[model samples]
Target: MADEIKIQEIVEFLLKHGDGYDADEAREAAKQSIEEGQPVVETMCLQMLAEHVLARIHDPSWIISRANEPDCEDSELLKRLLDSGASAADLALFARMSQREYLSNLGCILDGAGLYDTPSLPHEEFRIFAVNDEDQPTAMIDELHESLGFSGLETEMELSRQAERDSDNAGS
Candidate 1:
């Protein structure tokens, strides 16, 4: 019961302040929650860490500074950049050319990179039904992704497909 309360408090805190809170602050909060016996808090902390890393990766100035460091090996820098959402082409350009040249060619590199095909993750969507009028059998079917503030259209389609499969299996 105590653990449940702590988890609920953590969830409420995240829902209330997640957007406004920096990754470090969120991480600290998650840590405190963990120390309070909330094992699930680690998941939130990991998410915050990923967000912090991605934010750093997306900052152009940070990327430039890291790229310009002479002591840093190109492979190490490339790996970090990739993990942060840098395209493979960008890393290739960075490896082979001077920073100035790389910057000058960035647009072209991106355009050319777009020509290569890449596999995308499959989308899944799920819905929750809230029945407001039981007599009329009317329900509000909320897409799971939308309720979670996710970009839901693709996920909804995927989930709908999965639900169909599950229903078919159940019928069989």
Candidate 2:
């Protein structure tokens, strides 16, 4: 199929780049992975290629700059979630965080799988949201303070809540 040929081509190109792999070895590995029905070999080939690419990232700015592109925006699903479920106070907590805190928060969020050895993902239709397993939002927020060093976030969330309560009472 076209996909198989494309993958073999990528493997050949990466191996030819002298990452301790020769063109002949790439051909043999690619053949086994494609013609011999050993798909896992292709996975190894791609992982080897990824390692070489990741090792070349000498500057964090390269990643930061690319992340600013519109392609990196939260998908339409998340935009809707914020519109419907998220509150002004929630947005305030995020908007007020320092740059360091923002990146730290993103790192913590991205690596959140650390707590689970094997996490069950939802169906594609529900993939935009975390699979809710009967957890309250407040409890999960509290847990993040301990798990991700988000004590400052926890405090900010509290202040936001109190201010909202004050405004509500004043409006009455």
Candidate 3:
């Protein structure tokens, strides 16, 4: 039996550090793919191992469409907080302790109500991986492939990244 956690780790490694990498996204894709139970997701992992490991080239198709989901629910008080003169810090604290129950492990909520664009992480920096298979590419893939192996299969790394919500602030 393949260790599902290990597969998630491999999926994350390829997306975060592999050829056409996005340092920010790999984690979420790791969780989603496992829960999603989609073959395309697995195929994506295979593709990443097969190609990016060998050739550091990017396929335009690799730029996939993803939903721009808010990491957490904005505080019911978010508007009030903003209205009352909460510093970004106040907002962050409120969000951390309260609002972000869903993706609490991912991080606290930093953007909400689309009032302004938050393009970066502030003050604290955090990076986490449920597993660290990043050190050895061939070894990691070899181990996973032999057990849950699929050879000669073309696939894409079913990775995902959360981008800021509409800058135009549409649908506010």
Candidate 4:
């Protein structure tokens, strides 16, 4: 019963994506889905395509997309905070709030608003994640950190040097 539904969904997705519904591929996916006991809706067609079709797509965009997706479990709360006009500090504070009701309700509202951009984090706290399953590729949260002006000591020194040079030029 479910296998049929899985086949239908897979076929529909493939068709929508212009795959033209090949029997061989559909059969294989269906077989794998049944063997894995995964719902038809859970078939990993997109993963296969990422591995095969758009293999050239860079790690950063892929990681950023995953980080931005509201449906993802790991960053779902952070995503909600961004949507709610909450800064990174707000998110961290919310995470500490004792009341679950307030947090959950606000999360739903933020999720419904469709805002999925990342929130600001400190420069020293900037995080990097391996966007994909493999650990070799990494994407950093530089923009959010830089936008917050959380520069490191080295960066501050460089800026100081540039400022001194500009002052000398102005005096001359």
lDDT of 2 by residue, 1-172 (tens): 8857755775666576535767677766666666654555544654566445444444344333443445644334334545676643444344344444544444444434222233454432222124446521222233543564645535756888998998899999
Compute each candidate's TM-score over C-alphas: 0.29, 0.24, 0.21, 0.23
lDDT computed for candidate 4:
0.52
* C-alpha lDDT of residue 29 in model 2: 62
Q: What TM-score does structure 3 among the candidates reach?
A: 0.21
Error of 3 at 149 (Å): 21
lDDT of 1: 0.52
lDDT of 1 by residue, 1-172 (tens): 7755665567666756466755566566655766764544444565565446444444345445556666654435445776899866565455435534433343233223322333342322111232244322246435633554635446756898998998899999
Report, for every candidate in turn, its global Cα lDDT versus the true structure. 0.52, 0.51, 0.41, 0.52
Scored against the true structure, residue 26 in model 1 reaches a CA lDDT of 57
Lowest lDDT block of 10, candidate 1: 121-130
Candidate 3 lDDT tens digits, 1-172: 3646655675666575556756445555555655665444555555555444334223212111111223323333344555677654544454344423423322233112222234554433322222235521232223433654433212211211112244235556
* Model 3, position 110: C-alpha lDDT score: 16
Which ranges in model 3 have alpha carbons more than 4 Å from their true place? 1-4, 16-24, 39-41, 45-172
